[model samples]
Structure formats: C-alpha cells, structure tokens
Target: MRILLVGAGLSGAVIGRTLAQAGHDCHVIDSRDHAGGNCHTERDAATGVMMHVYGPHIFHTDDAEVWDYVNRFADFLPFQNRVKTTSRGAVYSLPVNLLTINQFFRRTLRPDEARAFLECQADTSIADPQNFEEQALRFVGPDLYEAFFKGYTEKQWGCDPRNLPASILRRLPVRFNYDDNYFFHRFQGMPREGYTAMIRAILDHPGIATDLNTPYDPAMAGQYDHVFWSGPLDGFFGYRLGRLGYRTLDFERFDYDGDYQGCAVMNYGDREVPYTRITEHKHFSPWETHERSVCYREFSRAAGPDDIPYYPIRLVREKALLEDYVRLAQATPGVTFVGRLGTYRYLDMDVTIREALDTGRDFLARAAQGRSPAAFVHAPL
Candidate 1:
C-alpha cells in the first residue's frame, strides 16, 4: 500500500515509520523547508548553540512505552523543567508551591501550614467553578491567583479569565510542598543532539521517503491507498465551513553573551509585561555549555489565516465550528486525521507520539481485515 502521510512532524514520522516497517510504502510531505514541524531545532551559526526554531519543546511523559520509543532514536539527557515566574517585581518559583507561598507572604511556613493557609485563602463559597478565574480563586485563592495566574492568563489567552474554560487552570497545578519541578512526569528529558536530529533518525527508514517544503495537493490524495492528514482539520476542507480559532505565537528573538535568565523558561505574570514567557534555548540543553545564548520572548495572539496555529481556542464558537468539520471528516473516506492539529487539541510530545503509534497499528489491523480505516483514530472533540 502506498500511504500518504501529511506534515513531516512527529505524527507523520512516527506513523510513517510504523507503517513502513509493516511493509507499506510511505511518502511524507510538509509545507515547511525542514522536518519536525514546530519541534524543529537547529544550531545557531554564530554560537553553535542549538536553537528551538519555533519555541522550546521539553519531552516529558509518564508513558514508559512513549519514553522508550523516543530514546530508541536519540540519546535523551535527563532534564527537569524548573519554571520561574516574575510577578510583583520579584522572582518566584512556579506551581505556587510552599517556597513560593512563603516567599510571597514573607514567612517561612512548613508544607502543612502552607496548605492550610492556602485553603483558608481559597474561596470555598464557589462549590463548582465554571471558568478559569473562578477555578483559580477556588483552588489557589485570590492573592495567588492575582499575583501568579490572573495577569498571565489574560496576556496568554488575550481575554478575561472569566471567558476561558476552567480546564485551562488544571494544567497549572498548585503544590503543597517546596518541589518546584513544573511537571511530575515519570520520564523527563531532551534529545541530546536536538529534536530535529532525533526526528531525522526516526525518518531514516528504507520504506519511508520525506519531502520537505512540499505542500499537500488535493490531487495527490487520489493516488494513495490511504491518507493520514496531520494538518489542520479545517484546512483539509479548505475552511469552507469556517476557520477554527487558534492562538499563534510571536517571538521576539534576542541573544546574550553569557547566561541571561539563568533558567530554561521564565514566565512573566504581570499584565504590563507584553510577552508571556522568556525561553533560554541554551538552558534547554544543560549537558552542553556555550558562552553565548539565544532566547525568545513569546507573545500569544489570535492566529490569522496565514499564521502558524499553536494553541487551539476551543471556546463555544470554535467548538461548534469544529463539530461541523468533524462531521465532514467522518463523511469523507480513505483518510485518517491524526495528531494535535488534525485532532484539534494541544498535545504534549509524548501524547502525540503515543497517538501516532496507536493510529498506525490500528490502520494496519483494519487493512488486514479488509475493512476501511477510521476517519479519526481519536475524536477531535
């Protein structure tokens, strides 16, 4: 079977490699000049520092299979995400941990004491929180919400916290302990060489062929036995119904002679601060040292038609629109929508790979049974 895999990102690479190994001829294509999509990493010509081309991507997951899958391709060095946030003219550890609670209040409280204090601070009146603001106020309390979440939420989402869903606040967990590690995933690390190098290794299969800088043509679909569309869901249909809401990022790139923020990522929790976070790429690879560093100040906004979509704005309007697109995709034949953009959800690197692997196996099994492959391996909604 000659399978067409769209977008040479992780989804395409992993899925293509899987199918290829199963004796299916796979051809991968991407609009970008290089593979790996947003996870693309390249070396700085000046400093020889590895720069995360789009933005910083930290690989972390609890799934051992996903962890082992990536490690098989590249050497992953142990790296933990220690995120710091600048708020109220002071630097504080993120996740609103005991250290942060103590530092903000100017008191050295123990873990249990801090938890009790936060519970008292939290608004117990709101039995069921509906939006991001209410969720924050109920969990972290008013003071911490205003200091750490409110301003940052407004800037990042480009709207009032009340407008956003409560699920958004769930990702930013508040800790009772002093542990400041952003993610509590069992496996956490970065590819030693770079994500691009790792992806290239993944694509290095005899049955797979990758074509970068090549956009998908509607005519090409008829030529393949099956198509795995990893591009935007609405995009596949030419957005005839409507465009799905997505928040794109604008990065202000800067360089420094030595270390700048002394960390990989620094979040600006002040509304006055134009950008959301500052990512020091050098800090991403702590295993290698470089005198010079590269950084990006990320500013999030509504993604225009020409812009590259990052975070999906799955608000009321977009959800309705996405439903229409899903119906159309389900009605279509010989195509499977897979991965983040295709499924219209923000997925971590590990989740993306896990789904891709799952999708490939499912497709093969379906083909063997002489049955049609699913339009979606996972529901978009």
Candidate 2:
C-alpha cells in the first residue's frame, strides 16, 4: 500500500520506516528544508560544535525496546541531564533536591530531616490542588514555589500558574535525596552523530522516499492509500474550528571563545530575566572538545500563525476546542493523527517514538486483517 506521512519528524520517520519494512511504499514530507523537526542538530560554522538547532533534546526513557531501537541507528553515548536554575541572585540544583533545599535554607539537613522540613513548609490545608500554583504550594510551600517554580512556570507558559492544570506539577518529582539528575529514566543518552543524522539513517531504506521542504497539501492525502498526519491537528483542517493555544520559542544565538555555562542547560527562575534558560551547545556533546562555544537564550511566548508551535496550552477553553477538533478528526477518513502536534499534547522524544512505533504496528496488523487504522491509536485526552 502507498502511505503519505506529513512532517518528517521522529513520529513520521519511525512509522514510515516500520511500514517500509513491511513492504509498503512510504513517502515522508517535511515543510522545513531539513528533517528531524525540533530535534534537528547541526555543527556550528564558527565553533565547530554540534548545536541543537531547535533546542537541547536529551533522549531518556525507561522503555528498553525504545532505547534499543534508537541505538540501532546511532551510537548512544552516556548522557545525564543535570539541570541548574538561577533564582533570586543565587544558583541552585534543579528538581528541588536535598542540596537545593539545604542551600536555599542555609542549613545542612539529612534526607529524612529535609523531607519533614518540606512537609512543614507546605500548606497542608489545600488537600486537593487544582492548578500548578496550588500543587507547588501544597508540596513545596510558598518560598520554594516563588524561588524555584513560580517565575519559571509563568515565563515558560506565558500565563499565571493557576491558569494551568495541576497535572503539570504532579508530573514533576521533588527529590529528598541529593540526586541532581533531571530525569528518573533508566536509559538516557545523546546520539553520537546528532538527531538529524540518526533520522536520516532511519529514512534510508528502499521502500522509503523523503522530500524536504515539501509542505503537505490536503490534495496530497487523496493520492495515498492511507495518511499519517504528524503535523498540527488543527493545521490539517486549516483551523476551521479554532487555533489551539501553543507556546513558541525564540532562540537568540551567540558565540563565545570559551565554555559559556559549564553545563548543557541553566534555567533562569526569575521572570525578570525575560528568557527562560541559556543553553551551551558544546556541553550537550561532552565527548568532543572545542575551545570556542555556542549558546542560545531561549524565550517562550504565545504562538502566532507563522511561528513554530512548541508547548500545547491545554487550558479549559483549549480543551473544549480540542474536543470539537477531535470529533471532526474522528468523522474524517483515511488519515491518522500521530505525535505531539497531531495529538495536541506535550510529548517527550521517547514517548513520541514509542507511540509512532505502536501506531505503525497497529496499522500493519489492521491492514493484514483487511481493515483500516483508526483516526487515533492513542486517545489525545
């Protein structure tokens, strides 16, 4: 069968590769001149450092199958995301670990003591938290929330923390131990040749054909037996319902002769700083050495029609509108919504790849049984 994949990012590439191996003709298309979407990485001309063109993308997951799958294409190098945050004129370790807690309070406390201390600081009155702010206050109290989360959350989302859902904060872990590692995933690493090269390798197959700078037109869908829409869900329908809220990022690039931040990512917890974080690209690829450095100051704002959407702002109003679009997608035929933008949710690199693999396998199974795949393999809501 002939398949059309819109947006040649991880989702489309993995799914297309899967179908191609199954004796299906898969055509992958991307509007951008390059593939890999946000995970696109290229070497800096001046510094010779492998810069994360969009932003820093650390591949971390507990899924062994997903880890092995990525490793099959690129050499997986050991990489743990150790994040730092500057707040109120002081730098602190992220994830609000024991070291951060002790440093902020100007006291050395054991793990058990710190845990008890944190409980005391929390506002236990609010038993059931509704929003990000409340959840922060309930877990870490006002001081930690103001210093560590409040300003950063507001800057990242471009809204008050209360305006966001509680699930956002619930997903973030607060550590009582001194582990400064950002993620708890068992397998974490960066690709040796960069994400773009890895993606290229994924698309390098006889049954797979790729076209860069190729935008997906509605008419193109009619030419294929099936379509995988990895682009924005509302975009597929031309925003007929309404534009779902999304936050876009702007990266301000600058080059330095020496190491910039000494770390891959340094987030600014102060809203007054304008930009949320500063990323030193060289640190992302630690094995390589370069005297010259490249860095970016990342700024997040409400997405415009022309801007590249980053985070999905799934507030109450957006959820209602999303429901309307989901209904429309369900009624539509011969197209399946896949990945972050397609499903309209914030997805990690691992989750996106895992879903794409599952979606592809499901499609193959259904096709074998003389059936068409569903509009969504996984529920967006």
Candidate 1 lands at a TM-score of: 0.99
Residue 261, candidate 2: how far off, in angstroms?
1.3
State candidate 2's TM-score.
0.99
Off by over 4 Å in 2: none
TM-score of each: 0.99, 0.99
Across 1-381, the per-residue lDDT of candidate 1 in tens digits comes to: 999999999999999999999999999999999999999999999988999999999999999999999999999999999999999899999877889999999988888888888889999998999999999999889899999899998988899999999999998888888899999999999999999999999999999999988999999999999999999999999999989999999999999999999999999999999999999999999989899989999999999999999999999999999999999999999899999999999999999999999999999999899999999988988
The lDDT for every candidate, in the order shown, is 0.94, 0.94
Candidate 1, which segments miss by more than 4 Å at Cα?
none
What global local distance difference test value does model 1 have? 0.94
| lDDT tens digits, residue span 318-356, model 2 | 999999999999999899999999999999999999999
